[model samples]
Target: MTAGGDVGGHPVGPDVAEAAVPRPGPVRRFLLRRPGLVDAAVVTVFTGWALLLGLGADSMYWLHEVLGGPRVLLMQVTSAVLTLAGAVALVWRRRRPVLVAAVMTVLGVLSLALTGATNGFELGVALALYVVATTAPPRTLLAAAGASVLALLVGARVLPLARTVGAKSLGVDPDDADAFAAVTGSGPFGFATSPAWFAMAAPVVVLALLAVGLGTLVHARRQRVAALAEAARARAEEHAQRTRLAQASERAQIAREMHDVVAHSISVMVALGGGASAAFDWAPDRARAALDELVDTGRAALGDMRRILGVLHDDDGDGPAGDAPLEPQPGSLDLPRLVGRARTAGLAVRTSGLAVTGLDALDPALQLAVYRIVQESLTNTLRHAPVATDVEVDVRRRADAVEVVVTDRGGTAPATAGPGSRRGLVGMTERAAAFGGTVEAGPYGQGWRVRALLPWNEGDA
Candidate 1:
C-alpha cells in the first residue's frame, strides 16, 4: 500500500508499529527499503552453517547414537526437511505471519515425533513464536500459542526420553495411578502427570505467554497516543486558517471606506473645474479665481488621499500604534478653504458659529473623519444644487458635543446625479458611527440639507 493510505490495511501488520520502531539513519534506511534482499542474505548464511553442522563429526555421532539403528537416516532426513521448510517460510513471514507460524509449529511437532530429537528444528520453532507474537493479530497469535502448547504436551507424553526424565524427576511409580494423583493436582493442572512435571514445564510456558501479552499491550497504547496527537495538530491548523480569513475580511471593509472618501472629494474638484472653464470668456476674473480655488482643492484632496492610502498600505494598519507618533489630519481648521472654493464655484456660502481653535484636541483619526464628511457635503451641494444662490454652514461646540449643519437656499434646478451620490452618503454614515456620532442628509426646506452631531469626549473631531 502507499504510505499515505489507511495504516490498518498496510501489508505489514499493526504490531509492526511505526511508533515503537525508531527511524533508521541513512545506511540502515537504505537496507530496510529492500527487505527481500536482506532476508535472502541472512538465510543464505544460516543454511550454510546448518549444513556444516549436520556434516560435522560430533553432530553426526550424537544423532546416530541417540536415534535407533536403521531409523538414523530417517531422523537426519526429517531434520533437514524441516529446516529447509522453515528457511523458505521466512521469505513470506510478514505477508502471512499467522499461517507461517502455524506451519512452523506443525513442522516442529513433526520433526520431534520423527526423530525424537531437538536440533535445527527447535530454533525454527522459537523464531516462529517470536514472529507470531510480534506481527500477527491478537486472536491469531492466541490460537497459534494454544496449538503449539498442545503439541508440546502430546509430544512429551509419547517421547521415551521425555517419559524417562519426567518419571525420575516426579518420583511417580509408573504402574500406580494413585501415585500420579498424589504428585499432580486435578483439573487444569492434571495436564501433566505429576506436580514435579508441572513445576519443570509450567514456568517456561507462563513466561512465554507473559512476554507476548506485555508486548501487545505496549504496542497498542503507543498507537492510540500517536493518533490523538495527530488529531490535535490538525485542529490547531484549522483554527489558524480561520483567523487569517477573518483578518482579510476586516481589511477589505476599511479599503471600501477610504475609496468612498477619496472618490467624493475628487468628483467635486472635477465638477468645479468644468464649470469655471466653460465661463472663462464671459466672466474672466471670477472664472480665474474659481480655477485657482479648484487647483488648491485638488491638491488638498490628493494629500488627504495619500495619507489614507499610507494607512491602507501599512502592515499594522488595522490597530493602534502607541509608541510611534502620528501627524495631524485635516478637519474643521480647513473648513474656510473648503468654503472659499465652493463660493468661487458660483455658490454664495455663509459661515456662522465657526471656531478653529483647539483643533488639535481631537484624535487624528476622528479629525480626518470630520474633514471628509464636510468636504463631501459641500461637494454634493455644488454639483447637485447649482442654481441655489445662497448656502449656509453652521458649526457649534457645546460643553459636551459638537454640531454641524449645511443648507442651501431654495432653487428650481433639478438635483444632478454624480459618482458620489448613494455611495458617498453610506460612507459618511459609517464614518460618523465609528466615533459614536450620527449624520442626517436629505431634502429639508427648499434645497438639500446635511447635519452631523458628534460627542466632544467620545467623537472629539
Candidate 2:
C-alpha cells in the first residue's frame, strides 16, 4: 500500500534491484565510512597469526634447547611478549608509516636475535613497508624499503649462518645441519635447523619487493584517477558558467526589444491623441482620421508584442499559430513602416539617401541592428523635439560600411521626460556594436543627431 510496495503490512518487492539491497548494520556502516579501519583490521589479523605461528611452533622449542633449562622459560616468555607487542603495533602503520616501519623492524630484529624465528613479525614488516611506499615521500619510502630488505637479509641469512657456526663450536656435525640430534646430542644448543640460508632468504626478498611494487602502482593509479576527475569537474563548471552568461544575454536582448516596440508605439499614440483632441472641435473629420490611425498603430504594436512573446511561450511551435502568430522578426524591410508612422504623427519628416542598394550583402543580425537604431532615433526625435518642423533621415553606403543618420532641429519647448529614459540610446549602441559597428548620438549644429555605422560583410550574408 505504501510507495515502496508494502503488501499485507509487510514490505515486499519483485524488482531485483530493490530486493537485493539490504540495509547495512551499524558496524558495516562504520567500516564503510572509514576504509582505513578495515585495512587496519586486516593487517592486525594477519600479523597476529604470524606472531602465534612464529613463536609457538617455529622458534620456541629451538630457543629453549639452545638457552639451557634455567633460562629457557624467561626467553620463551620474553619472545611471546615482544612478538605480540610488535603485531599490535601494525594497527597504526598507516598513520605514521616511516616511524611504524622502523619500530616494527627494530622489534623484528630483536625477536630474531632472541628466537631465530620471524614469521609473525615478517608479515607486519611487509605491511609497514607497503604503507611507507604508498604514503611517504620518495626519500622516506626508499629508506623504509631498504631497512626492510636489510632486516630480511639479516634475519633469514645472517642469523641462520650464525646458528650453523654455533652448532660447529659445540662439537655438532655441520654437514648434518638438518638433523635434530646433531647439536643436542653434543651440547645444550639443539633442535633441527631450518633450510639453507639462501633457500630461506629468497622468498622473503621476493615478497618484500612485491609488496612495495604493488603499493607504488596503486598510489600512481589513484593519483591519475584523481587528476582526471578534477579536470572533468573544472570543465563542467566552465560549461555551466557559459550557459548562464548566454541565458542572461538572451533575457537582456528580449527586454531591449520589448522596450523599443512598446515605447515607440505608445509615443506615436500619445502624439495622435493630442492631435485628435485639438482637431475634434475645429475639424471633426481630421480628428476621426487621427483616431483611426491611432487604433491601427496600437494594433500593429500589439501584434509585434505577441510575436515576441510567442517565441518564448511556444518555442517549439507544436501548438496553434493563430493564437500567437509566429512570424519572422522584422529587420531592415520594416523601416519604411516605422518612418511612415512617424510622419503620420504630424512631424515634417524628410529623407535623402534612403535606398538600400547594398542590403543583400549584410547579415540578418546587422540588418536588424540598422532597423532598430533608426526606429529608436525617430522615437527620440518625436518625444523630445515636438516644436521642430523638419526631420531628416538618411542612409549612405560606403566601401566597407552602411551609415544611418537622423537629425532633428531644436523645438521651442524644452525636452520632457519619456518612457525608457536613456535606454533607447543604450539599446541602439548595443545593437550596433554587436556587429562590430559604432554609434554616435549628440548635438549637431543647432539640432540633435544620431549616427550609426555598421559593417557590411558580403561573404556572411
Cα distance off (Å), candidate 1, residue 369: 3.6
The per-model lDDT (C-alpha) reads 0.62, 0.71
Q: How far is candidate 2 from the true structure (C-alpha RMSD, Å)?
A: 9.8
Candidate that scores best on lDDT: 2
Score residue 441 of candidate 2 by CA lDDT: 95
Residues 140-198 of candidate 1 have per-residue lDDT tens digits of 77887777666665655555544433444455654566665465434554545455446
Give the range where candidate 1 is weakest over 10 consecutive residues by summed lDDT.
4-13
Cα deviation in Å at residue 125, candidate 2? 1.8
lDDT of 2: 0.71
**Residue 335 in candidate 1, Cα distance off native in Å:** 5.4
Give a tens-digit lDDT track for model 2, residues 1-461: 44454444544434422333344579878887998877767666765676576556534455456557557566566667876677567777768878878887787676656655555566667778888878777787888889876876566445653355334434455567455244423233222243344444555567678878988996786576667556555544554555567668878898889988998898889889989999999999999999999999999899888877665554665653347776766766777778888988877788776666666446777777887888888888778876576798898777788899999987767655455469999999999888788899998776789999988755756
| Every model's TM-score | 0.57, 0.77
